[model samples]
Target: MDDQNKNLILATVLSFLVVMVWFWLFPPEEPELTDLPPVAEAADVTTPSVAAETTSTPTTTPAASETVAEAARIAIETPEFKGSLSLQGARIDDLSLTQYREELADGSPIVHLLKPVGEAEAYFATFGWASAEGIAADQVPGPDTIWSVESGDALTPETPVTLVWDNGAGHIFRTEISVDEDFMFDYVQSVENTGTSNITLRPYGLLRRHGTPADLKNFFILHEGLVRMTDGELEETDYKKIVDYDLDPREGTQAVRLEATENGWIGYTDHYWMTTLIPEQGTAFRSTSKYFDSRDLYQAEAVMALQTVAPGETTEVTTRLYAGAKEWDAIRNYENEEGVTGFLDSIDWGWFFFLTKPIFWLLHNLNVIIGNMGWSIIALTFILKALVLPLAYKSYVSMAKMKELQPEMEALKEKSGEDKQALQQGMMKLYKDNKVNPAAGCMPILLQIPIFFSLYKVIFVTIELRHAPWIGWIKDLSAPDPSSIINLFGLLPWSAPEPGSFIALIAIGIMPIVLGVSMWLQQKLNPAPTDPTQKMIFAYMPWVFMFMLGGFASGLVLYWITNNVITFIQQYTIMRSHGSKPDLFGNITSSFKKAPPAKDAPAKPKNK
Candidate 1:
């Protein structure tokens, strides 16, 4: 085969392998149709901390669920959040993002980020003092301690709330909480000592989950577990990994702890949402990820160094909690404007951070300008194509030159039959004489692999694309196209088969069909290979991809379709410019014509 065909085969097989592996590793799950409870009945958000203790590892048992049920909750209302803070531990437990819903349905419940105790898979955040050298664990207010509202009745951006508890041991603990209009919660935890002796206490903030999130995607492509930044380094721990850690004898739980000097945050990151405990910047602290196997509880904690409190002295520590949608702009602001170091990395940019970051940045800005994610993706495709146009131009030009020299190369091949070395040397000389680089054509295809993977990461992991609408029938770009061929693109009365099912695997949607057609058209830009193997692979490649990618997010399929169409146009225009006009219609027509039966193999089988 000539270099052009070889390059095509390499690219085709590489892409096929990638998609096949992707299908095996993380097949899309069909979205459930049941409705989640409304905001009033939905009672959870991010994780609430496990009980505090004297040692670094938590030793105190969680208060009964009744404590959360009976504790008076302070109403938490903000522009982006709607929930309540439980007084039991001064935890911001029952919270939901007012801006997003659990599903695309009209009355779907809002996306609750944290849930109070007594709710299934309770998730919430709380900031409190862990006694290190203080009198006793009970001397400080703990999970069971009930705090009365010391100030504001409702927690709002305009009105901050304060909760106080007098330990009756000559010390009083107070937690003052405030929120921004966005998703961050600022807590100032303080303790005042009226006793004569000095006492040591370490202020800690934690996010505790009763179990793995019920809605966990559990996909390898997107992380949905403990994500923490210690010092400048980031670490992500899967639920299973956390469970597998060596047991901490003090707490009888698996725990991973690191001393974070300078800065850090610890939290659980879902696909599109996160709840993190961001200690005040410039502070030295300990970041911990712990899993209690018996309880199936996961806790992410940031505990500050112990400080001594003398008579009449007061100690205060500030920690921030981020619990809500992981909006790129908002998270970026938190890092750039709010001084959270390396906070932007929390978005799970994948190993291709170099490409994913810029791709997402361009896509996000394009979305802002165009006011539609679908068009933004198309615009992004154009922008990326333009960025790589120089390389693509060269590749196309080289392919066109190779095509022009095909007849002579074929004659050379026939003359050099059975002399492989001569054929190789002759082909090299021919390419060199024409100043054509065979390898140049593969560069763009190779470059596209990382870019394609990165864009996939951006669309799958980022909140901006969640439920983002493109056009009719593409309501959620993050989801597979709902208009299946079985339903006649929604024209038929019967419902389409559920995605991820065997039936839906074959009965794909309109977008994927369009995708397959676009690829086929792109292929028609060049004549089908004379070799039967190459011809069959090329012919089947587009349809194979269509089915494999049928269950992918509509946004990704849209990107692929746009990419294929743009590539066809670029190759066609470049070939025309290079004095080689592609007979697109003729090649497409010939593809359907019956091939002259394979010359009967010259009767070699009979002779054998």
Candidate 2:
């Protein structure tokens, strides 16, 4: 094989290896729930039971049979959210995001964030007190204890609601729930001890999901389970990992616990939504992520240090809950302004966070200014090319010199016929004299690998890219190219193969076809190799890439197309500047021409 063919094969193998390593390191999406053991109903909180001394238990006032609609509720109305809080446990459960939806189709149901406890897929956030010796389990508000609304008629951004539950033995528990225009909720739990003796209790916040969500993406790149930031460190645990945690004998559940000495938060995160408990800053708390095998329940809790309340004295603890879309700006604001440490990291930036974060940031700002994500991706490609233009220029110049030396190389080969060592020595001397580096062409390919992976990560994981449209039939940039050629770009009545399927891998799309065309055009800068094997490999490389990346996100495919076009323009200009004109049209025509037969070896009889 010639040097050009060797370089081509090396580049192709390296590119393929990089992608394979990426998939190996970060596996693809898998089923959300598999081999799920049958689960029993969660223990009802209404009846008085001996609560564990070390574990915090959330109690409610109604039986499990009661429907959410039958229970008294405090209506929640905000600029971005609309839902209700269940008065049965004063749990902030029934929430729906007014800004988002279940699908991109018109009139799709609003995205439901939380559900009441008695519902089929019970998911909700509840706050309660864990008692010590003096405070009886019944004295503390159990799940079955009914609470009456004391202050507000309804819960809104401007008007908060206060719930009051009296133990009837000189102990009163009051919960004041307030909402912001955004997704943040403030719950101030205060207790008044009217009896003579002092009582000790610990305030705790718990977020529970009875079963795994049905719509989990389950993708390796996007985390959809427990996420917590504690003492400047971020921790994320998947549902499977949490379920497999070591059993906590005291709690009788699989659990992982952390003692957060300072600032910390704990919650559950979905693909585009998250609900986290933000305990008061500067306070120490015990954080726990538990999976109750009996009920198939996933729970994250922040239990504050125990506090004592004297007779006639009232003690109050304030905690915040965040439940809404994982918008970049909103989460960043919470991180920067509200001092939620590493809140932005909760978006699953992955191992390439350094690249993914800034890449998405620039793309987001470009989209805001340009008003199109697809075009923004194109612009980003241009910017990246411009930034690396110097290196690319050197690489192209070296390639141009190599092409210029081809005639001399052919002459040397003929002169040193059958002498492999002499041919190599001559070739090395020729390259040194020309000031060309054989490895220079590999630079551009190496540089693009990380950028491509980072951009793929950004498009796949960020919520800002979710449902973001570029143009016709491309309603979601984050999703795979919807226009498949197999269906003739939707001309056929049948649909394309499902994503991640074998058929989808081979079924090329319009973007992939465009990508193949761009690559072929770029290859036209040089003539096809004379060797049949090399020629075949070069001929099929573009189509191979087309099929390989056909199932990738449309935005990434757009970037690849843009990059190829820019590279072609750059190489053509630079090669011309180096006094080597690239005959693209001539190369295309000559590719079809047959090679002349090999000449007979000169007679060796005369020398013998």
Candidate 3:
């Protein structure tokens, strides 16, 4: 079609697109599911590795194979990691290692148990080591570092695994395998060093993680805790694995590499509190030391170098791992455990921390008082609106004065229809004469944008709002509206969109119409300009706003709707005082008592 028509269509389309995108980006809240506890099984079986037949050649001797098989069996059977020794009155037994639901002193949740099946297997990739390279179920063990033990009684039976090193050099690894009650066997391995030069190795430690399939049946994804910096900023960090890593054609293995740094690092993940111990810290890179962010899974691995000692000087590294759900309070006792206690809450912070932290604190405190998150949001909006009301009042007064002088403006516009420059000059002169500020209305609205952004963060990230309720038909405020629009047969049912709750949808749908109409009416009552482009812009403002609101939060719409209703009432009052009707298209002619002369300047006559 024509350029003007095309421009109008384009504007409408652009408005519609923005609305859909905003709706998708910032929809209503939904409830989150709680983390489930680990499941109990019946019989522990010794399952074979995929490469058992091919890799078993080394440990194939009858005696060696038997020993290896037994070791594998013991490791697979126990679901919890048990240490064989004790310190003081407490004994490090299977119970200490069993999957215990304990909390750290800081009140974070944690699970203490043995290595996660998926995580243990993933660790094999560090240093290019593979589970297949170790002893497999059907494979025979050789006379190398690879060895195995079967029965539960034989595997670390009351014996603490220890590390001895001269500068922490050389490498040694041991293993055991067994199945659980459900016939699911897990493989376990321990690595140590007995050398010098601080015994720093390229491939460091392994952190066991569960496969995604296992996670689907249990566990949830949530930030383990928050971190505060010296600058008073706070950050949210996640330490729990969501979905378990997949073993087949694994996207989980993408983080299959590692790097070493001289600074030395300590890494730990918690359900909320339980943290792994570092027997001997070492700074080194392990090829399989990468973290993965898969479709539905997350896992992290960390390693560090311990203190260095000269030749003839010896040091020991001993660590115990507990795998299970977190018991926040119980783990707190570990803070005094001597080795490492304040390990789970570490998080990274950058420059933005200072700016974002107070915002979080404000939101946090607000959450406590309002109990209902939706109401909390309303409260926040009211506070912000109140703060900016002075600027809005200034804008409103300016608009009122502009309406009072519309007669003079319209006379100038009609008199200078053909002379654009003359018309502008006349308009400016009138504005100057009347001491009006044309930009007054634009300034206040501009200041409100940042507040809007802050509100978005409050609604989107606060876990307190997850599954929160707001009046009727909105069982979960955090989730999208539950109304559906699917057509099963020939009939169209009353299905709303996924994020459209009956109340919210009604509010959302109705507010915009009201907003649009109110806006149109406001425009009509205001002074009209002679510039065709200006006229066109004012004409399209209501439609543009409507489409923009289509994707806005019902709460945001509620705010706008309230603001508009108030303004409409205010404008009506202003009009009655002047003894005239409010125009629907920003025409301010009726607000005045007398028509003024055209303000456009007369052009000089041209000689032929």
C-alpha root-mean-square deviation, each candidate? 6.3, 5.7, 13.2
Model 2 scores a C-alpha lDDT of 0.78
lDDT of 3 by residue, 1-608 (tens): 11233355446546656765565456533424343232111011111112332221111212222222222222222344433211100112122334432421245343333332222211111111222432221222112122322223433423322211111124444333332321112233334434343322211233323322222211122234212111122223333322222332322243322233321222233322223322222323211222334222233333333223334443333333433323322233333442223322231212333423454455446667877655665565556556667777766666666666655665666777888777767776776776677666454445655454454443444433444566554445444433322332114566444334334443344446666777776666554544466567768977777646644544555445555555566656656665655555444334354333333434322222
Q: Which structure among the candidates has the greatest TM-score?
A: 1
Candidate 2 clashing pairs?
Answer: 46-144, 59-143, 60-142, 60-143, 60-144, 61-143, 61-144, 61-145, 62-144
Error of 1 at 297 (Å): 0.9
lDDT of 2 by residue, 1-608 (tens): 24664767557765785875476356656555543332222352222122444554444333444444566887888899888888866888789999888888899998988977545677888888777757887688744446889999888999999999998888999999998888789999999999989888888888878778878777766788999998989998888888889986645567787888898999999888999999998889888888877667787888887878999999999999999998888889888998887889889888889988999899989988999899999999999899998887887777766665555566666777888777777767767766768677667877887898899988887777788898898888888887777899899999988776667777777889999999998877643443446668777888777876777788888999999999999988877776676777552111221222123222221111
lDDT of each: 0.79, 0.78, 0.38
Off by over 4 Å in 2: 1-69, 142-144, 410-421, 490-507, 526-535, 587-608
- Badly placed stretches (over 4 Å) of model 3 are 1-299, 308-360, 479-494, 497-544, 559-608
Q: For model 3, what is the alpha-carbon lDDT of residue 479?
A: 48
Each model's backbone clash number = 12, 9, 97
| Superposition TM-score, candidate 1 onto the true structure | 0.89
Supply the global lDDT for candidate 1: 0.79
